[model samples]
Target: MVTLDKDLASIQEVRDLLNAAKTAQQTLATMSQEQINKICEAMAQAAYDNREKLAKMANEETGFGIWQDKVVKNSFASKFVWDYIKDMKTVGILKEDNEKKIIDVAVPVGVIAGLIPSTNPTSTVIYKALIALKAGNGIVFSPHPNALNAILETIKIISVAAESAGCPKGAIGCMMKPTMQGTAELMKHQDTSLILATGGSAMVKAAYSSGTPAIGVGPGNGPAYIEKSADIPLAVKRILDSKTFDNGTICASEQSIIAETSNKTAVVAELKRQGAYFLSTEESAKLEKYIMRANGSMNPQIVGKSVQAIAQLTGLTVPASARVLIAEETRVGHKVPYSREKLAPILAFYTVDNWEEACELSMEILYQEGAGHTMMIHSQDDRIIRAFGLKKPVSRVLVNTPGALGGIGATTNMAPALTLGCGAVGGSSTSDNISPENLFNVRRIAYGVRELEELRETPAPYTETASINEDLLVDTLVERILAKLQ
Candidate 1:
């Protein structure tokens, strides 16, 4: 008896899944909007029913984030995402502009290669599956190895529900034995129509380089700016709420706070009152060492960790009630840990002279790392809010809301999604909160509204050019006569 190598077996598994997904996608592409909606509804309900179970499994398996928060994320991914996309027309004739004599037809992009991250594995799987199937596309997941079990379990639940609702068999699948080679095969597969990649920068880059069209997201280093006119206590509350939610596991959470100088003291007092521990200069330096790896990427060990856990890991002492740790900083760069994205219950504090300077600092922070991701501002002044909206480089400029919840559309009117596209500035293809609309292509049926004569000048019967040629002959003769005379 012979056994296949682990990598080889994984690669073979990917090929098999791709073959199945291809056939499944063909069937899905032929499905009507109602049929797709029924399958999506069933999958969403199943995921919602198993939300707590999957959330606990994710937390236990990956040892990241709060289980209760994971439950919220799961519910958001399942219920909120489905509700948002349930009524969207994604098949057949989507729209017809009789006045303009044009028709818009929705076409599924076909088989999708979904890359799930370890941070929000279950929720991401649910969200991806919902949007993919809602848009009439089949999905094959490449689960992060650390959260493979949870992701696989979620997929299994959804797959069963989907099939029972008339979804094609094998339409939803995950790589049980995930490997780099397997993921590469999945992304580069001939049958894979598009890649919905939501993970680290390196993985997104790999997906973009796989010679396949991909919608990949980038890292988020969102800064929450509290203008002087804002309510300092309420601003601090929202920022803390965002930073501490899921121990800051969500990439869109606030990474730092930029407060105006006039309100800096008040903001600090409010932050402290809300259980944010301000680190001393020495302690700040100590914690900086753990924020990022030696290679300059964020250290996974500190990601999704609580304030107490981060303090213990960095050998610092903090109050037991502290929900977040803050470090004062003035610089923004690759070497500046506090100025970068810390996916934990930690934040960097900066003071600017006024809103103008705050805007400048926000742009500097985003440009340093998380351009085209998200930013937030707590401002009662509409002018200030509009200014930040116009000047910020980020895709989502959340106002007076927790960056984590607002950026993910949980507390805002944006599309509910787990995969947030960072747009061109962040090297992504889109800047929208990814949705089922993004998963399908639109084919335009345009009528000929004008005749070729409308584009032409009726040729003027060639009389105008005929006169010019005739006049040229006369002028040539006169010039020749003049030349001979001279």
Candidate 2:
């Protein structure tokens, strides 16, 4: 009898799925915009119907986020995301400029390899499927080991509905056995036209290094600055609501709180009133040890865990009503776990002298990490808000709203999306909130708009046989061409 190892099995699975997906993508490439949207609508509807069940499965399998909050995330991926992208054209003629003599046509990007995170498995699967199919690209998902069951079930539901709506079979595939080796194969596969990578920094970095075109996200360590002119109570409420939601699993969730010295007293009081527990110097030390591992990555055990759960893990006595944990700190570095991305119900607090000081501090913190993710500020002063928004390196500058919700466009009017691109500075290809449009490329059909000599301001008088010094001219042209080539 012969037995196969999991790694070989995983690699075989990846090859089979990609081959089938590539064929299906060929059929999708010929689909019309309306046909693609119809199939996506069916997929979205099926996801919405199974949201609760998938959410429960994700929570029970991974034991990361709250099941109830996952339900909301699933709904956002289904209805909200679908509503935002339902009408936008992603195929056929995207734009036609008669005056400019240019016509823009959308082309499918072929097969996409998606990397799913355990933190938001089901929701991420649903969202990626919607956007990928909307653009007429077939997708294959590599599920996180911790959330494989939920992801597989979600894929099954959506893919069935999609096929029912006339989408080609094998257009949406998920690996049954997902391993690191298998994921690498998926990313490096020649049939994979692009990779939509979302997960830990290591996995995202791996995607980029696989010699394939990829769009990835970096770690988020956004700070929420409570300016002096802001509504203190409302600001704190928004922070708590965001932090406690899914136990801070979202990468866009605020990792730290910054306040002007003038508003420090009121901010702290409001934070305390609304279910925040400030850790003492001793307690902070205890929790910091568990926030990150010896190698400095976020500890998976605490990720998406509630304050009570984290406190128990760290052997600290935290109140039952505490929605989040706070640790006042004056330092920022990878060595200091509080200053890094915790991805749990833990926040670091800092105080600045004024708005300008707050701005400087925020910039410094983001520079330390999360250079192109998100930042939040609460202020009624338009001038200050404008100034604050100008210099930040983050992709999104959320104002007067929860970072988790606002960054993902649930609260803000930015595009409703699950994958938020961090731009070039954050190691992502684009800064846009990723949509179906992002999954396809635009091919420009352009007409000759001008004469060749019109490229220069003053034309050398046009005559076919007017030049006299042919030998000298050829020598000069050859030298210039050599210079340019060199």
Scored by lDDT, the top model is 1
Query: How many clashing residue pairs are found in candidate 1?
Result: 0
User: Each prediction's TM-score against the native?
Assistant: 0.94, 0.93
Candidate 1 per-residue lDDT, tens place, 181-269, comes to 99999999899999999999999999999999999999999999988888888888899888888899998999999987788888999
Candidate 2 at 214: error in angstroms?
Answer: 0.6
Worst 10 residues of 2 by lDDT: 455-464
lDDT per residue (tens digit) for residues 1-486 in model 2: 877799999999999999999999999999998899899999999999999999999999999989999999999999999999999999899999999989999999999999999999999999999999999899999999999999999999999999999999999999999889999999999999899989888888999999999989888999999989899999999998898889899999999999877889999999999989999999999998999888888999899888878887889998888888899999988798888887898999998898888888888888888989999999899999899789999899999999999999999999987788998888888888889989999999999978877776785785768766889889989999999999
Clashing pairs in 1: none
Which candidate leads in TM-score? 1
